[model samples]
Target: MVRTAVVNRVQDLWVSLAGVGTGFPTGGVRVVVAPESRLCPPCWAGIVVLGDSGIATAPDAATAGFLRESLTGRPLRSAVEAERWSGERGVVDVLGPASLAYLDESEFRPATSDAGIARLPTGHPALARLVADVSEDDVGESGIDEITSAVFVVRDGAGVAAAAGYRRWPRSVAHLCVLTSARLRGRGLARAVASAAVADALRSQLLPQWRARPEPSRRLARQLGFRELGDQVSIRIAAHQVDSNGDRGQPGGRRP
Candidate 1:
């Protein structure tokens, strides 16, 4: 009994450390507090952040309802979440299975960049179309523009099937996102686009951050020289109780 209670306490502490709350949808896409939107983190699967908080599964109606009730009017002051790494604070060395293994310059090879650049055209319809087809939880028009350094529409001389983009961040951090059409299933377009984006980020001195979905995708990332940063975990709770500094305990808690 004592061990169980202790374990629960520890788990609760972990939850508190990760600044978690519900994401509310606004303007089509669910708008949760994402610190790295500028970097255009992947929006297809779980949402990721560069700061203390990690990636979170976007809240749906059921999830949102739970958050609204739990947090109420309280404010979440901290940014915390489960980190995939076990370190005090450091760069994520994602160079193993489940990541792109190519060196920085290797990413910029002609073959990779070629497809990524072509997919996203000027004022192309791919953006809106992708959002419409993918999920009702799109970030809307702004999301279309926000997710790309430049958009490319991938085609095989027929019609547009997939769209790709590159996003960058300070301190050598970068990422890629590809929106594929429903008709084109089991195609390798996403991987090609990802390679291009990684190449671009490497050329510009931005470290690549890859967020792959499902086991196969994760395996691809690993093969491509990108390692999983770690599983970003989140939980909902009363916002007022969250701590900003990595410190948690009773209010007016003594300084360590």
Candidate 2:
């Protein structure tokens, strides 16, 4: 369970991400709040409130209804349990059940000198080349452009050995992402670059947010002084559109 203060901060962050004047629904499920025409991710709409209580919101009333029906009666003790319940329903795709970690300035520790490391501009050609060399699809061109902070890269004769950076989320949160070349899998380059990025974020007074799915990523977060804030689960409904009458308008399909 997350602390009440952290939960409040998370809610504020969500509201900020959703844009000005957007607020959490009073109770039950309501339409998902997003910035302008941008669609919020399905999991982003479902939040774990007050510990075990899971609230699912959507952009439309129909989707809200679907989410409400899916999560209303369940006791979700953790993000993993929420994911399992969402999976069995067969109408949504579950992501996470992963750790939501963060680091404060006092806890951050920068890596020691490493000659192979360098700070790269967001969307730098070398960074792109590195990502390509590593065959990483998680962070794309758009993702690089979205990052409002520094990008750190480590290179070897082969190419980019590792890369790390953070994208600006609402409420001064820096969402960290890291990737390492397959050839350098066991090396400490990932940790080195990630530490550089974290140090930079702390200098800017931005709380570094690490949502780690992979075990290595989680370990790295802890190594960099990020504490486990909580767990999160996100669900994506199969139906692309909802009708005006709060209905899915078609037989729903399921995704894993």
Candidate 3:
């Protein structure tokens, strides 16, 4: 039941991002004409086009102008090409690559409630420790502020074994984030906590979005029933403008 609702929500978000009057561009390039603010807050400035072929425009005018020129005669064919072009043109310093994906709530299997997994209220004391276990830069993007509605944690004798939760995003999307302590690696704790968070997201009628740097993270998303929708590159105007959050932005031109 939740699956159907999530699918509909995903469609609505795509429509909004694509702009009100425009339809999908021909030849597999789906252009999002709306401003970045109207789309995702983390995205600063640039054209974020996603579809069979995904491309992120450079944020700065000069690099953005160059990207427009490159795309005038040819459409971006693949993420690899996008990365290659940026590197060759020295635009990699300004643009970061990322994978876009959404959970297939239809395929999601509810994990049996585990006694070890505990759902905590926002601002719980334990949350501070869990956040500390992960990268400090991610605290903001984790959405653990006053508006956070749900937080799930798995605790071991040492401390937080893993944690997961979602932040509200535009279009009723749940921006999911997860973290597992280094010592607990390979224990499936990440998946366990993530499952709890996803279940909560569905119960609240929110769609789960799993956008991250492609790789092990993608593998984890797949394990939790997310499928790749497309890819995008993000324009970074300054080192600080780019998010250091694990799920949002990667610094130093790291592919996310």
Candidate 4:
């Protein structure tokens, strides 16, 4: 089980992302309009379910009212059950049921570094080659290019075999992003690089969060001493629903 402190910190992060300025719920789900919310795309509605505490958000008043009226008082899981609640054009795409885990400094188990593993800039040539080596879909899933922190990588020949980093998100959330080339799968490189990145985040006093949709990625996070506290899901409002209002991957990962 995760510590109470861990869950509270994660819940607090989502509360900030929800942009509602309301206290985290004690039970059931709460809905609010947070057009400025970063939990999901600018215009799209989203949800973050933490145990029994759930927060759902929409970009504007009308859609927000629809969701607030339809979803509040429902089970916390309803936050992710867009098909049942979003009646307009229905759900567009659901991001998860992704594992949301966080690292505690005391529990962190750093991976052993290899001679070839080193820190790299996000724009390094090896990273570019690694991106080209992987499928476009996988590249997008990994979010390799979007990280705001220094990248850790293991090299194969001259190109990267695996890489890891995190986005410095709001509330000091270090949202981890990791990728391992298919050819280098099962080589422990993902763990090596992810370990370095997580350690760096910890040294900076950032809360390192690993959100993984893929079981392999989830396992890697667990191996690194990140306790699974809850789960995450982001929802997209359908077109017709958006007409009334205005608004806004599993990246390839190897087993730890």
Best by lDDT: 4
CA shift of 161, model 4, Å: 0.9
Query: Which pairs clash in the backbone of model 3?
Result: 98-256, 213-256
Q: All predictions: root-mean-square deviation over Cα?
A: 14.9, 5.2, 8.0, 6.7
All models: lDDT?
Answer: 0.40, 0.61, 0.58, 0.75
List, in order, the clash count of every candidate structure. Answer: 28, 3, 2, 2
Clashing pairs in 4: 43-247, 43-248
**Model 2: worst 10 consecutive residues (lDDT sum):** 34-43
In the range 1-256, model 2's lDDT, one tens digit per residue, is 4445545665566555443355545543333433131223523344433233333345444555555555555554532455465645444566556677878677776677656778877777766566665543555421444666767888666456788888877788888888777667787887898888888887887778887667877888898888775565555655553544554433222211
**Model 1: per-residue Cα lDDT over 1-256, one tens digit each:** 1223322332233233323443322212223433222212222112223212222332233333332333343322121222322121221222111221223344333343353346355456645555555654322311335454666566644455566665553334555555566667467765666566566666676655555434655655665665443333233322223233444322111111
Instruction: Point out where model 4 deviates above 4 Å.
Output: 1-3, 72-74, 81-89, 241-256
What lDDT, from 0 to 1, does candidate 4 have?
0.75
At residue 90, candidate 3 shows an lDDT of 28
Candidate 3 Cα deviation (angstroms), residue 199: 0.8
Best by TM-score: 4
In TM-score terms, candidate 3 sits at 0.71
* Model 4 TM-score on a 0 to 1 scale: 0.84
Model 4, position 231: C-alpha lDDT score: 68
